[model samples]
Target: MKKLTLPATVPVKELAERLSVSGPELIKYLMGNGVMASLNQSVDFDTAALAADHFGFEAESEEAVAEAAPASTRRRHPLLDQSRADPKSLVARPPVVTVLGHVDHGKTSLLDAIRETAVASGEAGGITQKIGAYQVEKSGRKITFIDTPGHEAFTAMRARGADVTDIAVLVVAADDGVMPQTEEAIQHVRSAEVPIIVALNKIDKDGANPDRILQQLADRGLVSSDYGGDVTVVRTSAKTGEGVTDLLDMILLTADAEVEPKADPKVGAVGTVIESHRDPGRGPVATVLVQNGTLRVGDYIVAGQVYGRIRALLDERGERMQQAAPSTPAVVTGLSGVAEAGDVFQVMANERSARSLAEERGFAAKQQQAQPVRRITLADLASQVAEGSVKSLNVIVKAEANGSLEALRGQIEKIEDPNVKVVIVASGVGPVGEADVNLAAVTDSIVIGFNVRPDDRAKAAADTQGVDVRYYDVIYQIADDIAKAIKGLYEPTFVDVFQGRAEVRQVFTVDGRPAIAGSHVIDGRIPRNSICTVLRDGKQIARSRVAVLKRFKDDVREVARGYDCGITLEDFGDFAVGDVLEAYTVEQQNL
Candidate 1:
């Protein structure tokens, strides 16, 4: 029997048409193996290999098939080598660019002007609301623009050390020269190390001053092209469309100087998510940029924890696109859950395989959590190291607000010793409580509390359980003490004894469980089962039992100054994130 042959590349729509299946139907089939794609998106040869397997065919390589097939059969697959064609030779390849600037700096207006211009020239109007990537042709050259909101989202990717941008267009309003966000954008672009073209926007406004903007740019080390500097700065009014073409021309020149890599459709697909969000209509929607491989409809994909077949692929203009390759960003529908923004995505073989890989990853995460962490104090660290115990300093940070929490966390993470590292077991914005104490107790870690205190019952519980609950209003003190602890230079200063002044930070309500109060060590280490008193407004509120003591959600022996713990009250309750927990121990003076 003569063997039936398939083309290496087929139009995404044509495949569905030939198979009498909808675009989404073909996409679902492709996605079974972990290639997230949509109907309009094109699938390459390797992807077709999987699709052919689904159809019960022994998939053959494109080269092998080409050698076996007659010339008449080869012409049917026109989309196969389009992406592999020379990037410079192909006028169809759109230049992907991102616009970045400060808030209210006409960043949106510039994009609006571009959209308006394209529409006025007979392009579609529905493209404006799409995520910043879109195709616009200027002087018959295709250009793709990514309209990022500000440096926050721009740098957010860099925080993960991923550079997904090809070119960065720094939008600086002529009237607003060198704002904080502008400097931030400059820093982000520099950090990203991508080529940047400056847009001196809103030039038609009354307050416009291009010269001042240029001077400000010089202050930030950005020397403009017109001033013998390498940076290209274009002054334009988005309202009047003046200098827009000049800006586009400069971008084209920049792109011409830098060659973009073309992908081999025969290889497996690897991509990155430009954006992702949860939608009511769709479970998880992600905007993906195919950097080096071909993505087709129905390709199964793995992005972070989510795994699903490509249900749909929407372009920046909300139009269904057949295929996306290098520099092509498309909105993909069909993920198990919302993947984090900037997560790397790749195509897999089948739905079952993709699900298996995802499940394996999930199990691995659980296994990681189950793995034991070594805790070495300053006194025991050297001996432990000699005994082959190398571990990080496990910590639980409790703060009053998000900013302080983040700031302190960043500073603590900046402590760069390999032997001594800081691992935040759990952190939240609230008062230290019983849960914190219990966690610390188990992990043998200290919980640091900032601008918050613990309650009466929590203090007694911490005292009874010997869990540490440390409080600090100043951030440097916390960092310094942690450093000292890591270095074994931590001294029990400030009375080397318990006077019992402490505070509360938070209270946690575990479902179907009793309430746990989060508290801090205000003054002196609250020793286990020490005599304690509960004072509210300098008066005895109630005397209760010390029910539990926890550190980093783990049971621990004790906690010292500048630490936090979780504690349960014996009888009294009513506690919150910023209440004080005072503890006391009788000082025995031997003569």
Candidate 2:
């Protein structure tokens, strides 16, 4: 059988040709699998794999193939300790931890209690900490706690390839058995492969059932050791100082038993930027967690594309420090610009080499893989509503995670309108597929996607059927949009529709004119005067409007695949050979 290597998404016509079959025949096969797609419409990897199998072909995704590479030859993350450094120089370091749980649960309260107890127990004068992380000493051993907005930020940093948390302290309220956010946190921590130590909070409250909470944790696969499981459970209350020290001890014990984090302090400092901002007095300030080596004042450091010599180093207590050891988080000032959260920070030899390396990284990452999540704020969707404008507003909710699904549905139902009512026609998890669009078309409902995009089949179906689909990353936007729509203040949302993709095979430069990329339409059709993005090595390099397009010396509106053409971008001049251009058109969608 023939073997095919497929990207995350593939156009139907292109896949049909690769399968040595007609386009209609492939469409028939897709219909048999309940996937509706036109010849030019793209399909995800799973769908394409099934089609390839029907024709006696083996298909594998690019990601799977990369993961199958030999471990010896594959490059490792530069920040990891196992990547380099001599074994003789390695020394034991404290484990960094993050507290996560439901919103009402005492995650912040637990952190505050630890800090307060730390000061009251034996520590000398303590200053109010403003840095994103802090360390507390127990029995002469220090434990770092990263202050973040629960598992959302924790999971986000991990997604960027920074495993900052060595242990996850899951704070579960005794009163509430297990909420949606608690379950979500558990899934995220488990996926990160971090050891979880349950902090059963609110045991001091009336009718706070610790047994019920322990049973709920077991149901979620985090069984306590008392129940014959390996998970460590600690009972504590932020209201009173009960079991707070035990929680800290549990962190230390878990660290020693599971994660023996060590690093060579003699080498240059390497850390992860937890937070950064433009401080009016201090300039660009960054809160970094030192994972290896020792970061000292006057050390040249590079965090992502920004690099500068550290002028000052301060701990989480806001006290000046000469150096920060492994597992110690410090606030540093003197970076050229504000480093992004989760960016790897490395101490370099000198200023010149650091600047050169930073410049090279900046050019390569002209646009980093840091694709911003589509965040639609409340102010963007907020509008005054007119009474009796909408009798009923229908919607179909879809998300990438199930934990947020029920909460989103409940938030939508809670929106009170004087005359109109909100109705959820259908709700599900995963990407929006053809079946979702079909349901929306028949029910007169708009599809709402949270932190997920629609598949090619769904996009094509929605476009053809005139069904509106709105996507948002944060839940606040979805709730606000629904509230506004029900109040008769419905505002239209604009989305990008995939047009086609082109690959630059060659470059032609004429005298006294701009250079044109000799490109071939690899899939679908590239229309003239459309928005285009230049992608090199799977990373977006530039995005601009199509200024000029031609085919064989003649101005044409669109050039389809299997045809060669010349194209020029409006504002982009740097076009390398092998660069792929993805074309798109703006579409306005409304409730």
- The positional error of residue 517 in candidate 1, measured at the CA in angstroms, is 26
Clashes of each: 89, 0
In candidate 2, what are the lDDT values of residues 311-356, reduced to their tens digit? 9998766779999999998999999999989788787667865675
Instruction: Return the TM-score for candidate 2, rounded to 2 decimals.
Output: 0.56
TM-score against truth, every candidate: 0.52, 0.56
Worst lDDT 10-window in candidate 2? 372-381
Clashes of 1: 89
Q: What is the alpha-carbon lDDT of model 2 when measured against the actual structure?
A: 0.78
Residue range with the least summed lDDT across 10 consecutive positions in model 1: 72-81
In Å, residue 464's CA in model 2 sits off its true spot by 26
Cα lDDT tens digits, model 1, 163-196, are 4666889989998787756765675566455788
